[model samples]
Target: MTFARHCVFDGSSVGSEEWCASLDEKDKGDWSANEAADYAKYCVF
Candidate 1:
């Protein structure tokens, strides 16, 4: 869940699209496709 913490939750505000978008430019710092999919499934969906 580190990806979520740093890229999704650790923003100045949770769910901040601008913050998340900034971190997303780093490609979540080495997250795998499967992990991203699972986050999407459990957290996003």
Candidate 2:
């Protein structure tokens, strides 16, 4: 249950919307609400 390879972190930050949306369904399914929030915070806005 690891998706670390699919993610891109800069220090304590994550990647962009294109990267977020690039995740496949299986990888995305493993995400928690907090992960989604982080993605929205860094990637969406």
Residue-level lDDT of model 1, residues 1-45, one tens digit each, is 988777767654433555345446656657678646654554462
- What RMSD value applies to candidate 1? 7.7
lDDT of 2 at 18: 52
TM-score of 1: 0.35
C-alpha lDDT of all candidate models, in order: 0.56, 0.58
Top-lDDT structure, candidate number: 2
Superposed Cα deviation of residue 30, candidate 1 (Å): 0.9
TM-score of each: 0.35, 0.40
> Which pairs in model 2 have colliding backbones?
none
RMSD of each: 7.7, 8.0
Candidate 1 global CA lDDT score: 0.56
Report the backbone clash tally of model 2. 0
Clash count (model 1, backbone only): 0
